[model samples]
Target chain A: MSREWVPFGALAATVILIQLVTMFTNTQYYLTQLIMAALYSIVVIGLCLLMGYAGQISLGHAGFFAIGGYTAAVGTTLNLLPHRDHVLVRMAERAGLTIQTTNSWGVDILYFSPWITLLAALLLSGVISLLIGIPVLRLRGHYLAMATLGFGAIIYYILLGSRFLGEADGIYDVPGFGLPGGFTFDGARNNRVLSYYFVWALVIGLMVLMHNLVNSRPGRALRAIHGNEPAAMAMGVDTARYKLSLFVLSAVCAALGGVFMAHYNGGMGPTEAGTLKAVRYVAIVAVGGMASLWGTLGASVVLNFLSLRGYFGSLDDAVFGVVLITVMLVAPDGILRRLGMYTLRRNRDTAPDAFPVSAEKQVQRGTA
Target chain B: MSSELIIQYILSGVTSGSVYAIVAIGFNIIYNTTGIINFAQGEFVMLGGMIAISLVPFMPLPMAVALAVVITAAVGALAQIAFIRWLKRPHVLQLIIITIGLSILLREAALHIWDEKVRSLPYFTGTVVTSVRIFGAYVSPQVFWVLGVCGAAVVLLSLFFGRTLIGQAMRACSADPLAATLCGINQKNMVTLSFVISAALGALAGCVVSPITQTHYECGTPLAIKGFTVAIVGGLGNSTGAVAAGLLLGIIEAFSISIMPMAYKDIIAISILLAVLSYRPTGLFVRREVGALKEF
Candidate 1:
C-alpha cells in the first residue's frame, strides 16, 4: 500500500484512465465535444462552489464567457484603424512610419494580434467582473440570480446587435493561428481541433486547482457559509470576502471557458451568453451535484456524451431535464454523495482499515 | 423626438406592460398561495395565444378566447396537481428548478406543436384605426383595450377575493396555511385554484395581445419574462402591487425609449426588477405571510 508505483490504486489514476478512454473513443465528434465539455466543467466547478458553498446565485455567467470569447475573436480579427492611435501615431511618425486614418470606423477599431487581444480581453473581462460582483454579489440567492441574468441578457444583445461583430448574424471565417516555425494551418474549423486540445489542457489544470482549493481551509469556510450563513458569520468567517472571492473565481473560470468555446466554434455568437444557456450551465452544475467537483466532471461528461448518443440530438435537452429532476429527487447533496454511500457500505464490509476514497468523506472530515 | 412620437411610444409601453401586469397578477396569486414563483406562468400565455389563434378562423372570436382561457386554465390546474403539488417536499432551489424545467417543456412542446410560426388573432373590437393622433404620434385602438382589460382584471380580482368564499379561503392560505387548514380549508385545493387563476390571466393576456404583437412559439418567454419582471418590480407576492407596478413599468418603458435605444426598452423593466430586489430585497410590497417564508 505504501509503494510509490501503487498509485494506480488512487482515484486520480482511475479518472485519468476514464478520461483517456473517453477521449479516444470511436465517436469522432464525441472526442471534440468531450474536450469542450471538459472545458465547460471548469466553469461549472467554480459555479458549484459559488452557488453551493457560498450560497450565492448568478444567472449571467455567460457575460464572462462573452468577454472571454470576444477577447480572442476580436483580438484575432485585427480591426481597422487601430494599430495607430493618436499617441501611437505620433510615436510612429517620430519613428518615420507615417500614420493616418486609412479606414472609416473611427480610431478604436484598429489592430493587434490574437494573443495580445486575448490578454486585453481577459484583463477587461476581469475588470468588468470585479465591477459587477462588487455591487451585485451583495445580493443573495434569487435576487443575485436575477441581477446576473439581466447582465447576461445585456451582454448577449451587445454581442448580437453590435456592428463590430456581425450583428445578429455574428462574425464568420475568423482567422486561425499559424505556426511560426514553418507550419501552416488552413481552415478555422480545422483549427477547432487544436483549440479543443488547448481547452482540454486548460480545463484539466483548472479542475486540479479547484479540487485543491475545495480541500483547503477557505474551502471549509465556504462550505460552512453554505450550510448556514449566520453560523459562518458567527464563527468569525468573513462571509462577504468569501462571496466576492467565489464570484471572481467563478467569472474567471467561465471567461476562460468562453475563450475556448469561441475559438473552437470559430467565433462566438450572442446565444452563447443568453439566459437560457446560462441556466443550462447552472443546471449542469446542479445535475452533477453542486457539492462535488467530480460530480460536475462526471455529469458534464455523461450529459455531453448522451446528447450525441442518438440521432435527434434534441433529445439531449429532454434528457437533461430528466437527469436534472431525477438527480434532484435522488441525490440533493449530489450524485457524488450517492456514490460515496455505495462505496462506503461496500468498504465497511470489506476494507475497514483503508481510508475512504470519496469526496463526501473528505468534505465531511474537513467540516468536522 | 416629437410629442406625438413620444405619446406613441408611451402608449406602446403601457399596452405591452399591461399584458405583463396581468401576468404579474397571475404570479402574485400563485406566490401568495404557495410562497414561490412559478416560472411556467408565461407558458399559459403561449398556450392561450396558440390555441386562440388556431381556433379564431373557425369559431367566434369571443368564444375562441373563452375556450382558450378554459383550456389553459385546465392545463394550469393540472400542472399544479401533477408537478408542483406532487413534489412532496421541495427545497427552494429544487422548486425553482422544477418550475424552470416545466416551463422549458411547455415552451418546447408549443414550438413542436405550433412549429415556430407567428400569426395574429383579430382585435377585440375588430376596428383597425391606425394612427389616431395622441400627443402628436398616432396610437392604436388595441392599446386602449390592453389598459381596459388590466384595469378590469384588478377590480374583478379584488371583488373575487373580498366577495367570495373561495377567494377568502385563498387569503386565509396566504395569511397562514396552517391556520387555514385548522379552519377546515383545503390548502392544497386553494393552491390549485391559484394556479388556475394565474394560468387564466396568462392565457387572457396572450389572446388580448395576439392581435397586435402576433403570436409565436417563443412569445411565451418574452411574455413570461415581462410578467416576471412586472411581478418582481411590483413586489413578489403583491397582487395589487403587480397591477400598479405593471402600469408603472409600461409608462417607464414608454418614456425609457426617449433616453435609450428601442432595443434597450425592455431592459428598463428587467433592470427595475433586479435593482429593486437587490436594494430592497423585500420587494415593493413586503407583506410576508405569517410563517409563509419558511422552507418546506
Candidate 2:
C-alpha cells in the first residue's frame, strides 16, 4: 500500500515544500514562475508520452496549444455560445449558431463561462488532433517531423492572417475562471497563491493519471511499439491506431495547458504558436529524462524558473537549443538515467533506438 | 487576370522559383550523399550573402561572391567534420537535431555580427533602375541573370554528376556506402565533399537573390522551410522533380496573393505542404525510395 502511495506522496511533499519555502521567503515572484512552470509541465508531460513512449516526434505541438488558447480567447471575446447576449440579438451568426437574447437574471450579458470555453477548446483540439493524426501518424521519422512542422507553420500563418483572431497582436481581456465559496482565480496579485495551488493540484492529478496509463496494458503496447514497431505489429498490436490515440492525447494535453494559460494571462498571442516554442518544449523534455515524469517536473521547474527570471536574457532560446544538443549528445537515455537511478532506467537500454528506420533497411544495415 | 499580368506573374514566379530550386538541389546533394537534411542549409545561403556583402567593399563584386562561396563551403565542411562525423553512435534524429542546433548557433552568430537590420546587395547585371520590357510588363534585368545562372547551374551539376569521377564516387557512396568503402572510396570524404558542394550552391543562390529579396539574420528559417517544401513536394531525393516542384510552388504562391491577403502568402506555402503530405505522402512525383542512408 505504501509503495503504491509513495509517488503521490512524493509529489504532495514537493508541492508542500515549495509552498512552505515560498511562505517563509515571502518571494511571490518565484510563485509566479512556478505557476508558469506548472502550466508548461502539463504540456511537457504529454509530449514525453508522445515522444518517449509512442516513438513519434511532433514539431507542431504548439499548433494545438494555439488552437486551445485562441479558441478560449475568441470564444470569450465574441461570446460564441452558452453566453447571454441580450443586446445584440439581430447581429450576424454562423455555423448554425443562433443569437438568442436572454435577460432572465434582470441583466443583459454577453459573457461565456471560462469553464465552458475550456471544454470547447479541449473538444476542438481533440477533433483537430484526430483529423491531423490519421494521415500524419502513418509517416515515419523525419518525414513525420517535417509534416508536423508544416502543420505548425500553417497554424502560425493562419493566426497571423486572421483579423478576428486579432492577428499578430492577439486577443486580450480573456475572463478568468471562478471557484466555489465566492472566490475567483483571476491571476491577481492577492489571489496568485490560490491559483498556484489549483494549477499544481491539476498537475499532480495528471501525473497520477499518466502514471496509471503508462503502466496499463495500453502502456505496455505503446512501449512495445516504441521499442520495435514491426515486432509489436507481429505481436498483434495495432500500431497505427495506438499512435493516433497517443497523438490525440498529447494534443489534448497541450490544449488544456494553453487554455489555462490564456485565462491566467488574460490574453493570447501568435507567439505561443511558433515552432520555436515547440522546440523549447522538446528541449525541456530532453533536459528532463525523456521517459521520466518526475524528471520532466524537475526540469520544467528549474528551466521555466530560470526563464521567467530572465537569467539568460537574449540568449534564452540559444540556451535551450544548446541544452537540447548537450542532453541528446551526452545523455540520450536522459538525466535520470545518468543519476544511477535503476528504477528510472527500467526496461529501456542506455543507447536508445532513436532512429525508427524501416525494417528492410535495418536488416540491410545489420548485414552490412 | 490579364494575359500580360499572368505573363508577368509567371516570369516573377520563375525567377524566385529558380532560387528555391537551387536550394532544393543543395538539399538533394547532401541528402543523397549523407541522408541528412542539413537544417543549416539555409544558414549557408545567408552566410554566403552576408559574407559577400561584407567583402564587396574590399574587392570586386565577383571576387567577393566567389570568396563567400568558398568560405560558406568551408563552414559546411567544418560542420560535418566537427559535429556530424564525431558522433559516437549517430542516429537520424540526433543528426537532424544537431543540425537544428547548428542552425540556431549560426543564426545567433549572424545576429551578433550584422544585428537585426535587413541588408541587400547590388544587382548583378546593373543598378535597380535597369529593367527589360517583356509582354508589356517591366522586369528587372537581374531576373535574366537569375534564370541564366540557375539554368547554367542545373546543366553544369548534371554534367559533373554524369562525367566526373569524384561526383560518381559521391553517388556511389549514397547508393551503397559499404560497397563503396570496399571499392576503395572514402565514404567520409564523399560526404564531406557533398556538404561543400551543397553549401556552395546554397551560397550562390543567396548571393543572387539578395538584390531582390534582401538578406537578414532571421531569413534562413523561412528559406529552409521553402526549400524543404520543394524537396518534399518533388519527392525527397529527386533533383529534377525538386526543380519542377519549386517552380510550381512559386507560381502558386505568386497567384495566391490575388486571392488572399499578402499576410496569407506564407500560409499558402505551408498549407500546400500539409495538403501534399496528407494526400500524397510519397509526393506528386512518387518514387519507391528516397534518401541516401536507407537504414536511417
Candidate 3:
C-alpha cells in the first residue's frame, strides 16, 4: 500500500548495518541505546495512526502519551490511591460506609493493576477525545485546527501545576512490573530494546488491523467523509459516526503508544507532551502524506533519524519548517516514495500522465 | 466567596472580556471581509504591548500606545499586502493553516527580536483608584477603562461605517463584493483597510489590557484562541455577537474557578466551547449571509 517500502527497507537495513558496526567496534552501551530507540517506535506507530489513517490533527498526543507513561510510573512507584490515605481511611472507619485507601500513605488507592490502569488510560483518552472531537470536528478547516491546538495547551498547563503528578519535575524511579515482583529487578531493567520489541510487535499488529480497515468498506467511508462530508452523507455514509469512530480509534492508538511509552521511559513529563512534539508529529504525517500508513511510518522513522543526527540540537526547527514547506510545494506526497513510484513506472514503460518524466521524454524525442 | 471577592472576579471577567471582545471584533472584521481567520491577530496585540514597552521609556503612556497602534496598523496592512496576498486564496481550512503558520513565524520572530522577558505598558487611565461597591464588593478602575475603550471603538466604528463614504464603501464590499466592484469600489484598498482596522483594534485592545495581564510572546496564542473561541460563539462575522460571547465566556471562566476546583477551571471553558459548537454550528445567535460576499 505504501510506495516507500523499498526505500524504507533499504534504509532500515542500512541502519541495522550501522548498528552492527557500532556493536562490533567494542561498543560499551549498545544494549542501552538500542532499548531506548526501540521503545519510541511504539510512539511513532501510534502517532502514524492518528496523523496518517484517521486524517485528524492533534497537537496534544504528547500530553496523552505523557499521561500513559506517568500513570504507569506513578502507579508503580509513588502510588496515587487516595483510598489508602490514613486520614481518609480513618474518616471512612468513623463513617458507616466503608471505602479504604489501598496504600497506608494515600498511595495504594491506584495500585489495582497496571493492565487496568493502562486500559483506563486508553479508554479515558478515547472518551475524552470523543467529547472534544465531536464539537471541534464540526468546524470545517482551520477553526478545528486552532481548537485542537488549544486542547493541547490546556492539557499541558493542567499537568504543569498538578502537585501529586510532580508538576514539571515529572515522576521518577517508576517501578517496572517484572516477574510478578518475584525477581528483584533493578530500576534500569527494562531498557529501550524491550520497549523496541514490544512496540514493533504492537506496530505490526496495528498495521495489519489498520490496513484491513482502510482497505475495507469502512475505509471507503472515511475517505468519503474526508473528500466531502455532505456528498458522503448524500451517499448514505454516517459521517458523525465515522468521524467519532476515527477520533476515538486514533486516540486509543495514541493512548496505547503512551502506555508503552510510559513503561518504556520509566516516566513522562511536560517536555514530552509540549507543542514542539505535537508540531513534529503533525509534520511527520504531512511529510508522510496523510492517510498513507507506510508514508507516515517512513516519515516518523526519518524524523527520528533526523533527531538523532543533532536535528533537535541545531537548525532542527528551520530544517523541519523547510521540509514541510518543500513537501507542500514540490511533493504533496512523501519525497523518496513518490520518486520510487515514478522510477518503477518508467522501467515498466506504463506511460503515466502524473510522472511528467515520461511525457518530457516524449516531448524531447518529438522536438529533437 | 466573599462579596468583595465576587465583585473582583466580575470586574476581572469584564476587563478580560473586553479584551476578548476587541480581539473577536478584529477577527470578525477580517473574517467578514476575507473569510480567513487571521491567526496573527494576537501578534498585533503583542506588537502593541511590546512597542509600548519600548516607547514608554521615551514617551508618555498614552502616546506610546498611540504610536504602537499606528505602527501595528501599518504592519497589518503590509502583512496583508506581502504574505497574505501572495498565497493562493485557499479553502477555509487551508487559509486557517496558513494563518497558523504565519502565527508561528510571528511568534518566533517576536521571541527572537525581543527577549522573553515580561514587559508592561503603563495604564492609560493613570494611577487614580476608583473603587465601586456592588453588595460591598470592590472593583478597580481598570475595568471601567476597558469597557470604555471597547464601547468607544464600537461607536467610532459605527459612525465611520454610517457616515464616511469610504467606510460605507467598505461595508458595501463586505455586503456584496461583486456589486461593490460593479459600483466602482477598489477592493484592494478596502481589503487593506480591513487589515488596518483589524490590527488597529487588536493593538488598541492590547494597549488597554496591558495594565492588567502585562505582555509576553506566549500570551499571543492564548489570546488568539480566546478570540477564535469567542468569534465562533458569536457566529462568524458578527461583531456584536462576538462581544457578547466574549463577556459570557469570561464570566463563566471566572465563576468556574470560584465554584469548582482550580484544576478544572480552565478546562470548563474549552469543554463548553466544544459542547456548544458540536451541538450548534449556527452559534448562539445565528444569521444567514450570502457566502459569496467579500469583505470590507
Candidate 4:
C-alpha cells in the first residue's frame, strides 16, 4: 500500500489484464494495437523525462526514432560500403579473418546483421542526440523546441529525398530480430504473440527503470532543474551534463522503439521523422501530465492505442493537437494529476494522512 | 558557374527569400508585441494562399487576394481573442501549444474543405511565362512581383511603426508591458492588432508567391520552418535582420543544391541554423541583447 510501489503494482496488473484479453479474444488485431502502443510508450516516456523532469523540450524526437528505423531498414537492405576495401573488410583482412556473409533472397547479402544493425541504430541516435543537444540544450523553452524542430525537418527531408533509404516510399521488408532458439519476431503467424510479449516486456522493463530513475538522486536533480535551474546549479548540480546525458538517453529510448517498430511493420516510412509525429509524442506526455511518470505511461497507452486504431481517421493529428492544447489549458499538470487532486480532496477529511503530499505540491507548482 | 546559372540562382533565391521575409516579419510582429512565438503564423500564409486561390473563381485576381488577406488577418485576430485572451495565468509553453493546436486545426480544416489537391493562382500581371533576359538568364515576371511586393511591405511596415500612433503604442508595449500599461495603452488591443497585421502580411506573401510555388494544405509547416529559420538566424523580433537572414538562407540553399543533392537543402539550412546558434545565438546582424536566449 506504500505510494512508491503503486505504479509497479498497476503495471503488473495492466500486463496481466492484457494477457487475459488476448487469451479471450485470441485475435492478433487487438494485440497489434497494444504492441504498437507499447512501442510508442517507450518514446513518450523518454520525452516525459526530458520535458517533464529535465526541463528540456525536443520538438524533433521523431528524428531520433527515424534514425533508429532507417538504421535497421538500410542496414538490412543496402551495402553501406559496397566495395571490397571497406573498413570492415580491411579490419577482417588485418585480423586474418573472413567476414561472415549471408545469402538471403530479398535482403542484401553485404548488409550488417540484424543485431548489429540494432546496436548501430541505438548508438547513432545517441551520438546524434549528443551532437544536437550540446548546443540546443543551451537554449531554454521554445527556442530549444525550435532547434529540435529544425533537426527533425532536416532528418525528414533527407529521408524523403534519399533513394537509398527508399525515398518517401521508405525501406520495406526489414529483417526481424533473431533469437537463439530460431524464434523470429516478424509479426507473422504465431510469431505475433511472441513479438507482443517481447515488446511489452521491454516496455515494462523500461517503466520500472524510469520509475526507479525518477525516485533516485539524479531524478531529483532533474526535477530541481525543471523546477528552477539556477537554484539547482547553485546547489552543485551539473545542469549541462545532466541535460545532455538525458537528451542522449531519451534519443536511445526512441531509437530502440523505432527498431522494434520497423520490424513490427516490416518497414518504416519517412513520415516517422515528421514533426507531427514528434508532436504526437509530446501530446501523449502532456495528456499524461508533465511530472508524473505513471500518468505519462497511462496516457501513452490510451493515446497510442487510439492512434493505432485510427480512431480519429485523417483528423488524427488535429485531434492530438487539440488534446495537447486542451491539456495545457485546463490542466497543465495533466488529467491524471487533476483526478488525483479531486480524489484527494474528496477523501481529505476521512483520511487526512493518506493524501499524497508530493503529488499535491507537484500539481500546485504545475498550475502556478 | 556560368553567368546565366548564377543569374538563375540569384533570381530564384531572391524570389523565395522575399516570401520568407514576409513570413519572418509576421513572426517578428507577434514576437515584438507579445513575448509569445506564435506557431500559427505560417498557417496564416497558408490560409491566404488557399483562400485567394479559392476566391479567384468568384472575383478578380487582385480583389480575391485582397479579400483573402483581410479574411486571414481577421482569423488571426479571432484566434487571439478566442483562445489566448481566455487563459488564466497561462505559461509560455501553454500559449505555444495552443498556437500549435490552432495550426493543426487550420491545416486539417483546409484539408477537409479544399481536399488534398494542390491549387495555383494566375500571375498578377499575365498568364504567359513572359521572361526578361538578364545576363542571358531567363527571369520570370513573377520574380519582379515578389520583389516589388516585398519592397512595398518593408516601406509600409516601417512607416506604420514610425509614423502611426497605434504602431508606436504597440512598440511601447513590447518595449515594456508594465510601463506601457501604466501609460494607458491597451496591451490586449495592441497584441490583437499585431496579430492582425502579421497575418495580413503573411497573407500578402502567400497571395503573391502562390502563382509560382502553388498552394496546398501541407505547405504551412515548411513555410513555418523556413520563416522560423530566418527569424532565428536574423535574431528573433528583428524585422530587418529577418529579411537579411531570409535572403542569405535562400542564396545558400540555391548554391547548396549545386554541390549536394536536392534533399540536402534542408540539412544545409539547419546546419547553418545550428552553427549560428552555437556560435552566436543572437544571430548575424542583431545585437546580443535581442537574442532568443532571453527565454530563460
Candidate 5:
C-alpha cells in the first residue's frame, strides 16, 4: 500500500513543479490548457480501466461526456424565473437548490446552483450509461464497437437536432461554477491559477481512487474477465455485472470531466459529443498502453494539452486518425508497451498463464 | 394522409432504401469473406460519388461513373493489401480501429482533394425536375434509375456468387478457409476480390444516389451508420434480407418526418438500430438457430 502511493506522490510533485516553472518563466498562461488537459485526463484514465482492464471498448464515451456537459450547460443556463411559481420550483427554491444569478447581459435570473447542476450531470450520466450498458455490454468485438458507435452517433444527432439544446450552435455564456470560498471556475485570467490547481487536485484525487480500485478484488475480477470471459464465468465470477458496473463508472468519470471542462470553458458544443472526439479518446488510450493507468494519464495530458493549445491547427482530427492507425498497426499493445514501460505487476497479470497460450503469444508477437 | 401522399412517401423511401441496401451488401461481402466489418465501407460510396463528379467534366457521365467504380475498386484492393492482408490473424478490436482510421483518412483526403463543397452527379436520364406520374404520385425519373441499377447489381452479384468458379471459391473460403486452401484456392486474393467487388458495388450505388442526396465529405459517417443499421436489421450476411430491411427503414424514416422535425430524421433509424440490437440482435429475418451458429 505504501509503495502504491509513490507514483501518485511523484505525479503530484510533478504537477506542482510544472506550475512553479510556469510561474517563474512568466508562462502561467499555459496552465489554462493544462487545466483542460487534466479534465480530459480524467476521462482517459477511466477509459483505461474499462478498455485495458475490463476488456470492453466503448465508442460512445463522448456521448456520456456530452451528457454531463450539456446537463450542466442546460441546468445552469435555463432560467427558472419564468417557472418560479411552479410547485417544484418553489420547493427547490425553499430547499436552497436554486440560485439567483445574472446572465452576461446583466439580466437577473433564477438558476440551479453549480453544485446542483454537477450532481444532476453525474446522475444523468450514470443513468444513461446504465441504460446503454445493459444491452450493449452483451455484444462482443465488432458488434460491441458498432453498437457503441451507433450510440455516439445518436447523441450527436440529437444534440444537433434539438432546438432546446441550441441546435448546431450549442450553448454558450455558461456561468462559472462557484465554490464555497468565492472561487469561480472559469477561463478568466485572474481565476486561471486557482482553476488550474483546482482541476488538477480533482484529477489527482480521482486518479488515486482509480488506482485503489484497480488493485482491489473487483479489479482482479475485471482482469479475469478480460483474460477469458468463459473461464472467468466458470470460476464463478459475475462477468456481466463487473463489465456493466465498470462501464457506468467510466461513463460517470467522463461526465465529471465534461462537467468541469464545460464550466472551465464557459460553454459546451455538439461537437463535444461527436464520434471523432470519442475516437480521439480511444487513440490516446491506445498510445498510453491500455493497462497502464499512469501511462494513460501522461498521454492524455500531453496530447490533449497540445491539441487544446492549437498545435495541430486545421489537421487536428487528421493527426489523431493517423496516430490511431499507426499505433494499432505498429503496436497493438500500445506505445508504452513497445517502450517496455509497463510495471512488473501488469506483466505478471497479463502473462501467458493468465491467458490462453495462442492469444497471449499473438499479442506478444506484435507483428504480422 | 391521402393515397397520393402515401405513394410519394413510398417512392422516396424506396429510392433511399435501394441505396442503403447496396451499402449493406458492401458490408456483407467483406464480412462474409473475412469475418471483419469494414468500417470504411461507406467511404467507398463517398469516393465513388466524388470521383465521378470530378470526372464528369472531362468525359461523358457513363464513362466517368465506370472509371470511378474502377478507381474506387482499386483503392479498396490497395487498402486491403496495405493494411489488412499481412495481419496474420488480428483481433476484432484492432481491425475495427484500423478500418475506422481508414475511414477518417479517406474522408480527410476527400476534403483536401475536392474541398468541402457538396457535389453531385447529373441525373442519369433526366433533369432534377423531370418527374414520372406513378399511381397518382409524382416520382423523379432518377428514382427509377436508382431502383433499376440497384436491382440489376443485386441480381448480377447473386449470379456471380452462385455460378462463377472464382465467386464459388470465395464462398468456400468463407465456409472453411483451410479446406478452401487445401482445394488450391488463394484465400488472400479472394479477400482482396471481396473488397474490390464491394467497393465497386458501393460506388455504383453512390453515383446513382448522388443527385438525390448530394455528396459531402462528412456524409459517409452517417450513411455508414444507417447502412449498419440495415445490415443488422436484415441479418449480417443475408443480401436478400438487407433489401427488405433497407426499404422498411427508409419508409419509416420517410413517414417519421410527418410527425417529427426534419432535424431529428437521423434519430428514427438509430432508435430502430438500438431497439433491434437490444431485442432481436439476430435480426428480424434470421432464425435464432441459424444466427446462433454464426459468430457475432
Candidate 6:
C-alpha cells in the first residue's frame, strides 16, 4: 500500500517544484496555461481509463465537455429578471441558488449560482452519456468509432445552430465561480496563482481517486473485458454494465473539466465541441501509454500546455494528427512504453502484477 | 410544395445521393479487401476536386479531371504502401486511428496547397445558370452529368469485377486471403488495387459534383460522415445497397430543409446513422439470418 503512494508523492513534489521554479524566475504567468492544461488533463485521464482499461473508444467526449461548459455558461449568463415573479425563480432565490448581477449595459440580471450550474452540468452530461452509451457501447471497432463520431457531430451541429446557445458565437461574459473565503475561479490577472494551485490540487486529488479505482476489483474486471469480452462474461463479469458505467463516469469527468474550464476561461465556444478537439484528446491518450494513468497525465500537461502556448501555431491540429499516426504506427502500445518508461504489462497475457518492470528486465524474463 | 418544387428537390437529392453512393462504394471496396474502413476515403474525393480545380486553369476540363483521377489513385496507392502495407496484422483500432490521421494530414495538405476559400470547377456541359427543363422543373445539366457518370461507373465496375482476371483475383482475396494465397494471388497487391480503384472512383465523383457543391478544405469530413452513414444504411460491404441508401439519405436531407433549419442539415443524416446503427446495424437490405452469421 505504501508502495502505491510513491508515484503520487513524486507527482506532488514535481508539481510544487515546477511552481517554485516558475516563481523564482518571475514567470508566474506561465501558470495560466498550466492551469488550463491540468484541467484538460482530467478529461484525458478519464478517456485513458475508458479507452485503455475498458477497451471502448469514445470520439464524442468533447460533446460532453461542451454540454458541461455550455450548461455552466448558459446557466450563469441567461438572465431571469423578467421572470422574477415565476415560482421557480422565487424559489431558487429563497433557496439562495440565484445570484444578482449586472450586465455590461448596467441592467440587473438574476442568474443561477455557479455551484448550481456546476451541478446541472454534471447531471446533464451524465444523463446524456448514459443515453448515448446504451446503444453505442454495443458496437466494436469502426462501428463504435463512427457512432461516437456521429454523436459528436450532432452535438456540434446543435451548438452551431441554436440561437439560445448563442449559435456560432458561443456564450461569453460568464461570471466567475465564487468560492468561500473570497476565492474565485476566473481568468483575472490577480487570481492567476491561486487558480493555478487550485486546479492542480483538484487534478492531483482526482489522480489519487483514479489510482485507487484502477487497482480495485472494477479495474481488474475492465482489464478482463479488454482481454476477451466473452471470456470475461463467462467468468461472471457483467461486461455491458462495466462498460456502460465507465462510459458514464468518464463522460462526467469530461464534463467536470469543462465546467471548471468554462469558469476559468470566462467563456465557452462551439469550437470546444468540435471533432478535432475530441480527436486531440484521443491523440493525447495514445501518446501516453494508454493504460498508464501517470503517462497520460504527463503527456496531457506537456502537450496541451504547448498547444495552449501557441507553440504549434497554425499547425496545431496537424501536429496531433501526425503524433497519432506516428504513435499508432511505430509504437502501438504508446511512445512512453516503447521508450522503456512507465512500462505496464506488455500484453494481456502477462500477470497484472508484472507492471512497472523495466523493458530490459521484461525482455530478459521473456527469454528465460 | 408544388409538384415542380418536389421534382426539384428529388432531382437535387438524386444528384447528391449519387455522390454519396460513390463515396460509399469507395468505402466498400477497401473494406471488402481488407476489412478495414479507410477513414481517409473522403479525402480522396476532396483531393480529386482540389487537384482538378488547380489543373483546369492549365488544361481542358475533361483532361484535368482525368489526370486528377489518376493522380489521386496514385496517392491512394502510395498511402497504402507507405502506411498500411508492412503491418503484419494490425488491430482494427490502430487502422482506424491511422486512416483518421491520414485524413487529417490530407486535409491539412489541401489547406496549405489551396486557401480556405471555397472553389469549384466549371460545369461539364453548361454554365451554372443553364438549366435543362425536365418534367416541368428546371434542372442543371450538370445533374445529368453526375447521374450519368455515376451510373456508368457502377455498371462498368460490375462488368470489371465480373469479367477481369485481376478483379476475380481481388474477389478471391476478399473471400479468403489464405486460400487466395494458396491460389498464388498476392493479397497485398489486391489491397493496394482496391485503394486505387476507390480513390479513382472518389475523384471522378468529386469532379462531377464540384460545380453543384463547392469544394473546400474542410468538406471531406462532412462528406465522409454522410458516406459512412450511407454505407451502414446499405449494409457494410454491399455496393448496390450503398447506392440505394445514399439516394434515400440524400432525398431525406433535401426534404428536411422544409421542416428544419438549414443549419441542421447535417444533423438529419447523422441522426439517421445513429438510429440505423442502433436498430438495424446490419443495414436495410441484409436479412437477419445473414447478418447474424456475419460479425459486425
The recovered share of true contacts, given per candidate in order, is: 0.10, 0.34, 0.17, 0.40, 0.46, 0.50
lDDT of 4 by residue, B219-245 (tens): 998888788889878877778888899
* Between candidates 2 and 4, the DockQ winner: 2
Ranking by lDDT: 6, 5, 4, 2, 1, 3
Could you tell me which 10 consecutive residues in candidate 6 chain A have the lowest summed lDDT? A359-368
All candidates in order of DockQ, best leading = 6, 5, 2, 4, 1, 3
Query: How do the residues B65-121 of candidate 3 rate in per-residue lDDT, one tens digit apiece?
Result: 899899989989987776556544333433443455556656666777787899876
Q: After superposition, how far is residue A21 of candidate 3 from its true place, in Å?
A: 3.8
lDDT of each residue in A276-321, candidate 2, tens digit only: 7888887877777666666777888899889878999988877887
lDDT of 2 by residue, B93-202 (tens): 66666777788878878888888899988898879989889988888998988888888898899888878998888888877888999999998889899889999999
Better of 4 and 6 by TM-score: 6
TM-score of chain B of each: 0.91, 0.95, 0.90, 0.96, 0.99, 0.99
True-vs-predicted CA distance for residue B35, candidate 1, Å: 1.4
Distance from true location, Cα of B264 in model 1, Å: 2.2
lDDT of every predicted structure (CA atoms): 0.69, 0.80, 0.65, 0.81, 0.87, 0.88
Per-residue lDDT of model 4, residues A42-86, tens digit only: 998899888877867788899999999999887766654455588
Q: Name the runs in model 4 displaced over 4 angstroms.
A: A1-3, A79-111, A341-368, B289-296
Q: Best by lDDT, which number?
A: 6
Q: Give one digit per residue, the lDDT tens place, for model 6 in B1-296.
A: 99999999999999999999999989988887888888898899999999999999899999999999999999999999989999866777778889989999999889888989999999998798999998899999999999999999989888877799998888787777779899999999999999999999999999999999989998898899999999999988888899999999999999999998999999999999999998888899877776774554
| Candidate 1 lDDT, B188-246, residue by residue in tens | 99989999998998898888888888888777766666787777766666677777778
Q: Is the docking of candidate 1 incorrect, acceptable, medium or high quality?
A: incorrect
TM-scores for candidates 1 onward, in order: 0.85, 0.92, 0.80, 0.92, 0.96, 0.96
Instruction: Looking only at chain A, give the TM-score of model 2 against the true structure.
Output: 0.87
Error of 5 at B24 (Å): 0.5
Model 1 per-residue lDDT tens digits across residues A228-293: 667789999998888888888888888877765665566777777766677777778776666656
- Candidate 3 residue-wise lDDT at A17: 70
The global Cα lDDT (0 to 1) of model 3 is 0.65
